[model samples]
Target chain A: MELFTLIDILWMIFFLSLMIGCGVLFYRLGRRSESDFFLAGRGLPWWLPAASVYATHTATDTPMWVTGVIYRYGMRGIWYTFFSAWCAISAFVSTRIFRRSLAYTQAEWQSLRFGGLGSELLRGWMAGWQIFMNMFILGWVGMAMGKLCNYAFGWPLWIGLMGFSCACAVYVLAAGYWGVVVADFQQGIIALAVIIITSVWGIIAAGGPGAIVSKLALMGESWRVNPFAFTGIFGGEFPFAWFITMMVISIIGGFGMGTSIDWYVEAQRIQSAKTVRDASYSIWAGTALVLVRNSLWAVAILGFYVMFPNIPSQAEYELGWFRIGFEYLPVGMVGFFFAAVLAIHLSTISTHLNLGAMYATRDIYHHYINPRASERRLVWVGRISTAILLLGSFVYGLMMEEITKWLIFALWIMAAGVWLPNILQVMWWRFNAWGYLSSWIANLGLSWLVVWVLPAFGLIPDLPDYLQFWALMVLGALIYVPVTFLTPPEKMDRLVKYYVMSRPLGWWGPVRKEAEWRGLLHMKGED
Target chain B: MAWIRRHWTPEEADEWQKEDWIAIILSTFSYIALTIGVALSLLMLAVGFIVLILGIGLSVLLFFVIDPKLKAVSSGYEKKQKEYLEGLERVQRWEE
Candidate 1:
């Protein structure tokens, strides 16, 4: 193991110690109640939680991946910004509904609205999938951290993986939700600062925006205009249909996946807000933060391309960002940049750990293993479960070497398995528990089957991975709709009360007599 | 009710403004401009592999000179934004 420079080593130690200190401080501060541990006592100001949510979601992989997308597709990656914009707006609109209901989890809402074995079954399955999705996300965080450590300190992948994961586990287990929130706020600021500095520096390094555009124009109009260009397996060499399919899958399927319960940190923040208006404002504020934060990273990646015209291929995009940071950044700025990277890794990893532990302790253990368990015992379980999940993630990180592709695959799986069923059940009351179960199983099963069987059968085209993902998603959704309708609808009363509260637009059943008698009738065309 | 409506406090106005779609729109546009400028630059450089391959020697020399200037300009804008927001806060305090 080659020893790092004194400057590098000291910088690393400083960040590591700071992270550990923050974790310890948060742990002591939040050890009072399960509510404090899990939800930060539900008293965090909108800005803090909103910032935390943005920071937690803005992973280190994001900039690098965005860079890769810009490198490969040019202008086409801009579409993703639009999609995210829509998702943000949608999230903002949904916050009012979520705030009014005041359910702890999306699954709880399902249960309250639609009681019986079906609701229970749906809740159990959704909870299980959430854990699985979180595990996958945690793995990606570990892998990204490992790559950064390898780049910065020449640490072995396993060492970096363990060091990062363990630190996150310690902080999250100790501080609980409060630690994650506070750390997220701090990290979010650091990440934003670093992104601004790096992107500006990168753009200047590349000879300014005008020069960069000129260079792109020279490469080929396709490179400048076509998003699908350079998207195929081996460059711009893939078939057209493949690219089309990938675009559809990533953009459209992404919307459904965005609505998943685990992905709703904004909703969590909104729900935790002090009042309805505060919650709504928090969502908008959070949306703004995400937009700004993501844009900053996007700029840096774009600037790097301009600076280093011979950008790394798509597979190496994430590593390329780190490489650029290491090679191009000024001497003192390197420390700051590395600090931001560490912040990104810690903020995301700790949030995942906290969330995963919530799933295990509240959704699983509290509900299934020991409903009568004391708050103290449940908190202990949360901490232990967080540590266990971190360890598992570290191990998974070791198994996986690449960060970007791993994240995309994990996201695809989540979109198909978790997001699809959960959204359908929530929005479409006609969707029964059996339908939910079957849809989830079929989606995952089909996605896996496509991955395994298509190549063997030569049915898989030499298209972009995104296209393949899109095709699979369409296939999966098509399969799900039929399966959903085939199954019986959930009984009325279990979900009727939720309908009354949420007033979600759809055919939910005849309005309750109580609603009619109390002059709460929605009217004929109210829906 | 008339007095409340006519002599509405500035704090109330600011609160209402936070909810205004106009603020969100302006913020979103600002975000978009920033994203486009950065994303386009990277896309150009990454896809312009042929130029890079041909002028590797020249590009290397050019990059060292260019990168720092970009950082300076970009950081300047950020600093301005920070100052502007701080100024707004001060003005609000003075008004109160």
Candidate 2:
């Protein structure tokens, strides 16, 4: 383990105190009402939440994963990170519509979109799933921090996992998202600055950009520098087909809500914006920053490859970016780097804590358990829920080691089967809550059969991940589509209200006419 | 009537028009070019600089095309937001 000077320890203490102080600073604002607790009263300008978006995504494991891919596949590996490009279209389309709907969470929006028993069931299920998903994410990311700390300071895994998360929960419990967003703005800047400095420093260490380029060429790995250097159309490790499938998923998926897992987090930022325009710009710009940050890490990983070209293990190379910061940065700056890691960890932890609490408090408690709960009572429920989530995350974090595979299966299976239904709910008026709900159920079972069950029984060869995505989508549609046609459309009154307020796109001709007949819609030339 | 719609009334902006599609296309291209361009540019490649510039250009055009429509939507929607929020609250309470 590297020895740290007194200055290094001081730097860390100072950063920690500053982050915790946000809770004390914003405590009044956070307790004013339920909206304030979860969304800062939904009155924030675009830039504040945009900064939060950037900070929340820059988790401790992000660099490790980015480095892992870049080390393995060179510049082409950046495409893997491009799954976030769903925000590209979402900023203009779903962002605007959802912002108009003014729903605090996607679960809340379901009841607004579809009426009656089906909508109620969908809402309850979504809220429960979100609560579970947030806890799972917190555990997954918290363990990543634990592992990093173990590598750096020789600390035990649980100490690293539980310690920083508990520190973050202080502010989350004190001020909810008020503290989270404010701290995120400060943390986002520090993390971005350090990321830039370390990347450039590493690039310089690898004999500067010019030298690095010449060295790669001499090493006969020039294809590593080319982003478009795919092995072949359908065969190689990095095939053109896989790239095309990813592009289609990333870009087209933006048209629907919840198409990407990040949408749930971005949904909070979307509602927190002051206006439709602000919401649009925030998602677009924040994700643009994310893509740019990935590029910065890609080059730094390239530099790591240059200096240590012969390393064969994926685990070692995955730590390339962190190793650059720890092994290369000057003595005092090592503390600064560690502090930025804290910033990255705390931002994500705080977000999930408050987000999970929001679902539990607003969707479950206030809506179902006690609709008559006062604003003050609701805010308290939010804090209590936040505490519960924090404690649950610790339990999940400890068990994460053994259950990692099953959770991975859960997240991946969720993506493919529900991908189209997610979009269809936004675009098609006839797609009811039953259809959307069925897609989720179908995806869970089908993903198992395709990915593991059939292959294990020798009924079929193991298909590649891209092919699994195709198979799941085709198989899932067969189930949900028939169910949708058999079921009646959403109530006309409910659809019209949603249509007038949110103005969704696609296949809404009859609803549009009905809305017009009811004198709900204003024509294009109307004042 | 111009090549791109730079002006929008709230009602017109409420519709999904060519301007929305144009913004989507430009936004998609900007992300691709920016990702590839920034990485290659860091390695000091000449093509990287060109692509990076193209990405920046597309981003600017996208803002211009979409801003007016978004602003119009926001302005119009803000007027009705209070009423909508009230309705939403009733729904949350099962009173609607």
Candidate 3:
């Protein structure tokens, strides 16, 4: 069969038209100012950001990643991917705090929280790091999109990367965050539709869910049906013990210890909401969308399991999502499936492009080079920055040989790298720039030692991924705490102001008392 | 010139001008409730495609009734933002 028949081609064209139309409709919404470009002028209603947050996260690789895990680990495997869900617990609390802080970017929050050369250094370092990280993530997702196209339709990887890159860049450049938000809402719905239909189709094709369960029963792996089949932490993805610890840290840090904390979430959607209440709702909305998205994939996996019950190796299991789509889906339905896949890719890449441009243009370029630059000039610079990010990701995507390895890199290394600093920056008032900088630097070195160097030399006997992750987090702490005490604390004036604005509940006891004494706050728990 | 610049103006207050407390409580709860309802219904359906009838029935019920009630609860605050000021005043007794 031809990869896409005429009807499928028509569906693809229709899908592309909607995406472009979404961009054009919102073209005027972000033209006037930097706020418009970065945060949709901070006038967005709750639902828009809510949809965008959920939409950007459900990228092309999300279903593939979900399927790969299920095929290997059964139902319990979802906990590995559902780590992002932990953010919702934190989101419920931070929305009030993030909206109140009013810092445009998370990097901008440093100067709001700290002062003197320490604040300056922290701010600059974080801005640069965020820009790099955003591009790196864009490249990561870009490569995944390329792999999907190559695997499903026999397209060359580089062409797939470049083609999608240009399409996303054009829409992103057309309207800034406005375009990104509108496109996300539309694309999120379309992608959700595709999943709903395909998942149901897959179920029907497999003789329904009963047949799937019966087949698994015959294989003597009935345990696969249960979601809580938590076999053991020692063997699976993240040793059970370490996974619990990580969850504790994630939840504690996300919600902030005791008081509400923002954790400098890179989600621009949160900051774009019209009110703190709106921001809070957006997180819940996003989390709900994600959970449903996963459940839909679960239904499809039931069909997938029925089709291929025994796999020779992990490679085939990971390719389960692709094989099911290519082999089982009906002719025109297959085209819509690919369109959905492309929709997923485009939505994610567009958000990253807009966010990266916001950081590069607002936080770095205009902040340092031309503090007084016109809104028009900054908008133009934003467009240019989006183009640079697009090309940069395309080049990086071409070079990446596999998506699974990068998955490990993102989950284990990057999570550990930011884990301590993100929590400490909010919880510990004494954690100065030196400490923050040291923690990240230490995390990088220690993570490298555990993840790469030790294993390569055969000195550590090739540790599991979870053990490597635990070592990085523990060692990161051992390095950063002493560094914090060694360095002087952030200046007092900065602390007092930030305390009054955020009313952050933490070790800021002294500062909180001071604010109370001065009547800057009427009473405790006012937030 | 240094590579760092502070865009966060200290002179400008970061105090978020809050929406009416009635609006916030109304909006947040409605979404949470509706979401949970939908999730449970879907879970029922996913247990077996045979139960998809139950799933479809529940989803339709949620869409027709639960979803609209949430809208009414939420938009009631927005539409009646002024009339609800007394409720907002009581909420402000506790909140910022």
Top-lDDT structure, candidate number: 2
Q: TM-score winner among the candidates?
A: 2
Writing each residue's lDDT as its tens digit, candidate 3 over A379-478 gives 9999998888887887667666665476556446657655767767776778787887787778778887888888899888787655666677788888
Task: Give the alpha carbon lDDT tens digit for every residue of B1-96 in model 2.
Answer: 378988888888899999999999999999999999999999999999999999999999999898888999999889999999988889888733
TM-score, cand. 3: 0.82
A36-123: candidate 1 lDDT, tens digit per residue: 7877766666687777767876787776666665555555655454334433333323454455455555554555555567667877
- What DockQ does every candidate get? 0.05, 0.84, 0.04
- The runs of at least 3 residues in candidate 2 whose Cα sits more than 4 Å from the true structure, single-residue gaps closed, are A523-527
The alpha-carbon lDDT assigned to residue A366 of candidate 1 equals 72
The deviation in Å at residue A456 for candidate 2 is 1.0
Model 2, A431-499: lDDT tens digits are 999999899999999999999999999998998888899899999999999999999998899899899
Candidate 2 residue pairs in backbone clash: none
The candidate with the higher TM-score, 2 or 3, is: 2
| Runs with alpha carbons beyond 4 Å of true place in candidate 1 | A1-16, A80-83, A218-267, A311-317, A402-410, A417-422, A449-455, A458-488, A509-514, A517-527, B1-96
- CA-lDDT, candidates in order: 0.59, 0.92, 0.66
Cα-based TM-score, every candidate: 0.75, 0.98, 0.82
